[model samples]
Target: MLSRTADHLYWMSRYTERAENTARMLNVSYETSMLPQSASAATKAWQSVLSISELLPAYYQRHDEVTLEGVLHFMVRDETNSSSIYSCLQAARENARAVRGALTTEAWETQNLTWLDMNRLFKAKKFETDPAKFFEWVKYRSHLSRGVALGTMLQDDAFRFLRLGTFIERADNTARLLDVRFHAIKNDYHGTVPGKGQAQFDFYHWSAILRSVSAFEVYRKVYRNVITPERVAEMLILRRDMPRSLHASMYEVVQILEAVANDHSAETQRQAGLLLAELQYGRIDELLATGLHAYLVHFLERVHALGGRIGSDFLATADM
Candidate 1:
């Protein structure tokens, strides 16, 4: 494939996945804020959403404070925010258009239609009163786009690139979510068992974290125990069975890269394999001992580095 086409295919999928995950983060924050928390707690939770999205700096540039309305507008509607859902979908659609022939008819139509519908929602200001519904719509459209591609597109290099984008984006998001919540609760739970109130507080926050990644039920089924910080981290970070887990995403990425391997893929493959093996063999206790925040920060850096290597190896071209 042409480097430009490969770049478009890869980024189109990444932006789509990013849009859905942004909605997931917003939904989690909105739901948690309604749980009768203190004003400071609510503000902190909202701020974490921006921080996890890596948009806190950009957000502060345009806004004075993190009000719910302001954050929602900045995250979902601000065209200037490149990582916003609006911008993600717009970029996805434009990339899809650029590589129109590389995509199946269903895939192209889904991308185009999602953009059109999003524009309508933006003009109608539908999210002002019904943000939850708006988030659901964004997630649903993303799912539709993915399903169309997986069900209709040929299982070739293009499909591999698409999957690579989805899983890389997912891995980064999952790591960020886990890291943010881990930091929030680290000091709260020293060595002592949490009191009843503290336990409930932990449960609520951890449950919200799992639900953000669609892992609440999986956590329940797999652990069948109370939601502790460590177990939540383990499930989201290391459990290969959990679809959105960091381990699962890295596993998929490694496999896809292997499938599409070329002479230039050695470094990308090596980095991906090392990351996946670390997650595959890692222990929750060891991770906690190492400082979960530090570990996660290192992981995020590695993921970012791997992304850059992949771009250089497979998608490097001036036109792209």
Candidate 2:
């Protein structure tokens, strides 16, 4: 496959996943921010979403008060925000157009229609009626696009690249959520500083975390109980059985990266191999023992660095 095609496929998948995770993140914040205990916490919760998308500073530079109105506007409607609903759909469409021959007619139509709907929804200002509904619609469309891609595309290098992008984005997003929750309200030996075991505490935040990943219902089904901090953390960050977990997503990313790089350059293979070893040998018990926040920040930073390595390894090319 052409490197350009591979790049498009990878980013197409990443942007779609980014859009979905962003929606879930905001949706959970909406639900959490309304709770009496969580009132006034929207800025912190939503700031992390912007941060994860690398848009925090940009948004702050342009405006003040990361309020629900400001952040939501940026996240949902800001064309400049690549992680916004509109930008992601536009990027997905551009990628679909780039690799038109590699995609099925159904796949192309689905992507195009998805983009059209997102554009129309943003234009209609229907998100004001009920932003939650609009975000849910975006998430559903993302799922539909994924389904069509999986159901229609061949299980070839292109597909592998798409899966690679998705799982990595998920892993990165999960790590960010964990970092925010563990750091934003953690109790500790430090003096009673701000955000130290606030009114909502980890318990309330756990629900937010669970909801952010769309794992609340599935988590309850699996564990069959109310949300717990440790269980939610373990399920999201460490559980191998759960597809959305950091561990599971990391596992998929490394595997798909390996598969995509296997027949290519030795450097790519070696990078993937190094990443795989980190995942395989790095024990979750060690992370849990170290305290979740400390471990998660380190893990997220490592993932970010790995993404840099990936870009340098196979995706980096100069414009002609």
TM-score against native, each model: 0.96, 0.87
Model 1, TM vs. native: 0.96
lDDT of 2 by residue, 154-186 (tens): 999878878878887888888887777666655
Model 1, range 41-92, lDDT digits (tens) per residue? 6777778889898888999999998888889899999989999999999999
What residue runs in model 2 are displaced by over 4 Å at the alpha carbon?
37-40, 187-202, 262-285, 316-320
In model 2, the clashing pairs are none
TM-score, cand. 2: 0.87
lDDT for residue 311 in candidate 2, whole number 0-100 = 63
Q: What are the per-model C-alpha RMSD values against the true structure?
A: 2.0, 3.5
Ten-residue region with minimum lDDT total, candidate 1: 185-194
Question: Candidate 1: misplaced stretches above 4 Å?
Answer: 187-194, 317-320
Once model 1 is optimally superposed onto the true structure by TM-score, how far is the C-alpha of residue 282 displaced, in angstroms? 1.2
Worst 10 residues of 2 by lDDT: 187-196
